[model samples]
Target: MTSTQEEKAEIILNLINKRKTVPKGVIYHDYNDADGSIKMQELQFLISLLEERGLIILKGASRDPILTITEEGLNFPGFEKQREIDAIAERKKEEREKLEIKNLKGSVFQVKYWWVILLLNSIISFLIAYLTKS
Candidate 1:
């Protein structure tokens, strides 16, 4: 299975965590054919994001970068915790959307029911008047 962006990031993070310091070439070479290894562009993107988040630092030139996890990153929760946090956030977002949909459906149903009631009342009144006159 293709690893997700998050999963790929976690994999890279774990590698850095274990080695403390890893050269750029080693990282690329190690994942050259591995299942979870990301593409070059994707790896760069992940590295940028991680650097921005203070999770990892890249030292040296663009072509020959060395990766080292930050102190905060080293102390960060395990990969499972990262996945759990992501899952919880996604679940909460879905739940909020579901609630909004339910409320919208309830409002629509109420309006439709009100219109039906009004039509029924009008018809009943008309029938009673006609019968009384006859």
Candidate 2:
């Protein structure tokens, strides 16, 4: 029986996770086929697959990193959780930003209330002086 997309993705993720370092600088030259360099392409597709799951990350072209498994990404209970975990993380970040924006929009800027604060301080000072004089 042919493996599902999930199965293929899981195999790749497990392979990378077992490595001490996922070769962040560049994929090994051997990983690619001599012909069309299709191995690199396949690895990239696999990377995208895991990223979709939220289990790995590849950032900065300068580094040309391979995605690594995340500890919290275990929730992708399925075999291909790495791909799911990335999406989950992204959605969670988006939600947090949304909630934060809502909170920010609900309140007025604190610096703008400086004049009101000054007035309150002036009133307290005036009352203290009056009591001392009395």
Candidate 3:
């Protein structure tokens, strides 16, 4: 990793490691302090760094849309906050899936349009030939 990336990872690790408990949202568990795993915008970047460095693992959370860390991920050197990092990883994956689904829908619509055009052309040609011959 580059020096800049390593530095950012350190920042994220420190913030998450300090958490005594986990609550909800992207803020601190205490709910008073602003300190947390990352600044709102940096959450995605932090997750990428964690995965790229093999600092965290992801497991499925009880909730359908959430993910938790698996048993295999106990602790990783350099990155101390496993859960926070895993959360980041899961969030990024969700975002990627959403975009892929959107693209798939668009592709399906394009294919459908092409098929409809072909069908219409064949029908028109058939009708014209039959009428002209008659």
Candidate 4:
């Protein structure tokens, strides 16, 4: 099966984490196809994404960049506490939105019910007056 981008990134991160700093050739070798074709573009994209996320630093010339894992990258895959906190916050936000929607539905129902009650009362009063006058 093909690896997802996140999975591929994790592999790269792990590789860098082991040595702290690795040459680009190391990564190219690791991702080389069975036929010996190098996946240069795919590897570059992954590296760029990791760099953008501040997980790794890419240095040296464009031809053979060096990859260095940051402290954040070391902590990224195993940062359970931060992930838990974020998940909890997201759940709370979803619950609050659900409650707000329920409250809005209740308010609309009340308004419609009030209008129906007023109409019924008016009809009853008009019928009562007509019967009394006759």
Candidate 5:
């Protein structure tokens, strides 16, 4: 699923929080993939957004760029709480799907065995009736 810009911002905050000093190259490496990379323009857009919002600041030399989060960024939109909630919901959804698959398999197995038992019973009854009649 494509993540929203809000989610991307949250991810940026998380990276900043963890590393304390993040470089531009690291963000590009982490966010991009075979599916697609976040456009350089997009990353620059977000950086500008954060800077405008006073959440982060560009630091270090221009040649050796880094980012430093402000106090506001540390507590950006209560991200830690939301991240935890999202994680919990994802785990629960996975567990629920696993349980549903397990139940479906169990039901299929039971139906298969039930038909076998039913066929055997019918055959046994027919054999018993024929023998008695004879």
Candidate 6:
């Protein structure tokens, strides 16, 4: 599937973070097609944006540039926000599971004491009938 510009930027940042320093050619090759066509312009634009933002340092020659992630880049706001969202989702999932387990326990209790419920219903019905008759 196609990725948004933000997503692509995040991917680039993640790669740089993992490696500390990465070759521009490595990233370019990843975006290149088997036919030898490359999305160099788009990649260069992203690199420039990152450099401008001080998230990364671009060095070496234009043809074989290198990228090094900055400390600020490691704690990128977008990544932080994503981590928070993931944590919220995980908590919601845990809550749902707990609720499901609670409901299941209630259901099991009802099932286990079905005979008592039936006996109580019978007594109540008999009492109601006798009261109405009187």
lDDT (Cα atoms) of all candidates against the true structure: 0.81, 0.62, 0.53, 0.80, 0.78, 0.80
Score candidate 1 by lDDT: 0.81
Q: What is the lDDT of candidate 2?
A: 0.62
Question: TM-score of predicted model 2?
Answer: 0.40
For model 4, residues 38-72, the per-residue Cα lDDT tens digits are: 47787788889889989999889988999998888
Cα error, candidate 4, residue 16 (Å): 0.9
Model 2, which residues run further than 4 Å from truth?
24-38, 79-134
Per-residue alpha-carbon lDDT of candidate 5 for residues 45-89, written as tens digits (9 for 90 to 100): 777777787899898876546988899788676545667888999
Candidate number of the best lDDT: 1
**Candidate 6 regions with alpha-carbon error over 4 angstroms:** 1-3, 31-38, 79-134
lDDT of 6 by residue, 52-100 (tens): 8789998888787899999989878774576798899999999999999
TM-score of decoy 3: 0.30
Q: Candidate 5, residue 5: CA error in Å?
A: 1.7
Looking at model 2, report the run of 10 residues with the lowest lDDT sum: 29-38
- The residue-by-residue lDDT of candidate 3 on 1-134, one tens digit each, is 55655666565544444542222232222222543334534555654555455544333442211212222322554433555788899999999999999999999998879978899999999999999999
lDDT of 5 at 32: 73
Q: C-alpha displacement of 132 in model 3, angstroms? A: 99
- Model 6 residue 71 lDDT score: 90
* Candidate 5 ranges beyond 4 A from true positions: 1-3, 33-36, 61-64, 78-134
In model 2, the Cα lDDT at residue 44 comes to 68
**Order of quality (TM-score):** 4, 1, 6, 5, 2, 3
